[model samples]
Target: MATLSAGGQQDAACMHIRELTMNACKVAHSAAGAVAEGIATGVNALLETVRPREIELDRLDREIDSAVTTHITGATEESAREMLACMKLSIGMERIGDLLLGFSNRALVAASRCEMEDVRDLTLMASRLEKMLSEVREAFEMRNLDKALAVLRSDAEIDRLRNLVFVRHLENPGGTHRSESFHVVFMTQALERAGDHVKNMAEEVCHLVSGQSVRHLLRSIDKPLEQMFLDQLRTKHAL
Candidate 1:
């Protein structure tokens, strides 16, 4: 009788342990799903901000800021830490957008008094930078490392264009008025810094996905890594 009672107790304890484990797994899965949903929502909101639509950029910034805060505070898992890092990167990218908008506003204000030729080069540079900005944002949304790396490479092009425009303005002070020259310099610096932020975000993406810091890797290496990711996607598709 004692043996029977002991065996019964053991079975009950095993069942309890199994139930506990299953419950824990369910909770973990629920938390992971929530985190993924939050990230997707945040990315979508950011894309809307980048759209050429008349939406207020400040509103998008506030939305992203709130999302980052919630993502960091709402979860207590290691994965949440990675998510927080990505959110921080997103914040930086969004700030770039804000800066770009400021430049646009300032350019519009200065248009009344500024010579078109004086600001023409700067305007062209701004247009190219804006395209790069869009590409970086798209890379993040799609998690395309290749596109992100391409955006990084394009930064050098932007820097070159900025330098060229600055040099032209310096060579002929009469070509660009003093105040306009200063404003151009300021806006160009902001755009260059925005490119840097986009590159930084690309590095964060690599770290988040692979647990590896490839920030030091050359742009050359990033190409192969991107190809590897593409190959993996292809394999998954085949399966």
Candidate 2:
């Protein structure tokens, strides 16, 4: 009877130990899950903030374009310069907006916010640009060299289009009316600066990815454009 009582006590102890082990495992799993969920929530909130800002920047760009077109066609010098300054401000503001969107998009994706549309064409360039910007931001955050390089290459096309727009304005001056030249020039300047802002963002991506400062490099790259603009301004002043 004594031996049997001892065996029974041992069995009870073993069962209790197994129960405690199982409970501990469950608690650990729960804690890990909570941490993951918190991270996901934080990422989603960040992305939503980015998306609306990008959209607003796009809207502002359109507004700048319209203002430039209108002012060039009918406005005086003071009015045109004021409008041009506003357009430049819009370009600067939009670049900042793009950076914010890029950060948010990555965070959202990391958090599993939702899938975005994937289309490729000139018609979809704006969307593509937005996606590329987002990827650039992600690369910067993750220190991804490949993605940063990709963004630099992709921005080349944007530069090309911007130059095309500027050249077109200079070559054609579009409107039948003579008074609109000032406004057209202003629009061309805004478009060119928009390209510069995009280039600046790409340079930032490169810096963030490689841990190298590229501000000087960008300034070097832009020298020709800057010189051309300066020459044009000097010629205008001479006249």
Candidate 3:
């Protein structure tokens, strides 16, 4: 066997980190897809997809741990930055998965019984969330601040769609059930939370590219969409 030189070992480790980052991104995308599939098919299919994907994500997380352990020692400044950024990105992705799982059970029940328009609204929301996942992936891949900002901007639309769902549900009243309104709430909240997590990953991209936090960078100087969402939310809570 040929003995590897010290420099060659470092190169291999950096490559491993890159691979782990790619796998982490794939896991996030898969989680988004699970919601889409669940909406298109039913809860059972969504549940199946989520369970296996979680196993894959757990496997990748372990691999990242092992790689970080082996090669992170005495790394150069640039390589260290890459490792740390990728680690944060992996975490953001994992949390997105967890958030998606949080409301899946309730969403499954709601999906089966909600009105066609409500279902349509939710399907649109899920598509938007999935697109955010794609943009966040691109932003990280290219280290592009613009793409990340776009992801940030997209959050407003997610909030808008969520509001639409709430307004329609409120107008109709007990469309699902009294207690089961929570089901609709969970589904919408899942989209909003998913968008927030995607925004977190986008902020990570901003930091990696600019060495500054853009988390507070004029994302919402004004209430986006309209005052209607807050109005809807207040009215719903009041009743």
Candidate 4:
């Protein structure tokens, strides 16, 4: 059997990284789904299922780390940038998985004590996160900057939901004892922070494909989004 050339090896390594990152995204998405259901339905058994998936995400993160370290030493600049993007994405997904697991644990303990409003907001956050992860997978797979931008835009809603929860729990006017307020707040934070990591992954996807940060693209371009993306692609190809 003939040994693969260096370029062939690098290509294989990058593909492996992409595959592992996609798998991690799926795992995180599944975790989010489980948390959403567990919170919405008050099912402890539903929440119990995320722990092993969290372990799978960690394993994928380590695998991505090793793949990048091994192949990035002698790679071309473009390939190296993509490999780094893969590493960033995998790390973000793993953190998101951990956050979802934490959220699930909190739900197990506090879902009973939470008010209807609290459960509604928490479920909404998890459901939104699940959708975001789905978009992250699609955006990364297709290198779709538009989808990535959409993910970035959706993060604000998560932030808003988190703030709503905080205001309700932190300042009750009647001097009432809010049972499991700490757990509710912690769960809110975990979902919000997971949204943040998802945003970072979307930014990395934009950067990986377009050679520009999401902030730069959104701030510097005055044209419509589709036009700006088209112009950028033209500029890249013309170089």
Residue 137 lDDT in model 1? 51
Expressed as tens digits, the lDDT of each residue in 1-239 for candidate 1 is: 34546445444433333233223223222222222232223233323333332133334445545554544443445435454554555455455555555554554445345555545545555555555555655554566766766666666666776777677566764574455666666656665676676567666665655456665454436555556556655787999
Candidate 3 Cα errors over 4 Å, as ranges: 41-43, 167-179, 215-239
The stretch of ten residues in a row with the least summed lDDT in candidate 4 is: 220-229
TM-score of each: 0.56, 0.34, 0.78, 0.90
Better model by lDDT: candidate 1 vs candidate 4: 4
RMSD of each: 14.1, 24.6, 7.1, 6.5
User: What's the lDDT for all of these models?
Assistant: 0.51, 0.44, 0.73, 0.88
TM-score of 3: 0.78
Tens-digit lDDT track of model 2 for 1-239 = 44535445444433333233223223222222222233334434433544554565566566555646543444444344434434544454465455444433443443232212111111123433444445444553455655655555555555565455445445655652333334333423333343355445555556544445554544645644345445555787999
Candidate 2, residue 69: how far the Cα is off, in Å: 41
Error of 3 at 215 (Å): 5.6
Question: Residue 135's C-alpha lDDT in candidate 1?
Answer: 60
Most TM-score-accurate candidate: 4
Candidate structures ordered by lDDT, highest first: 4, 3, 1, 2
lDDT winner, 2 or 3: 3
Deviating ranges (above 4 Å) for candidate 2:
1-95, 98-125, 173-195, 214-239
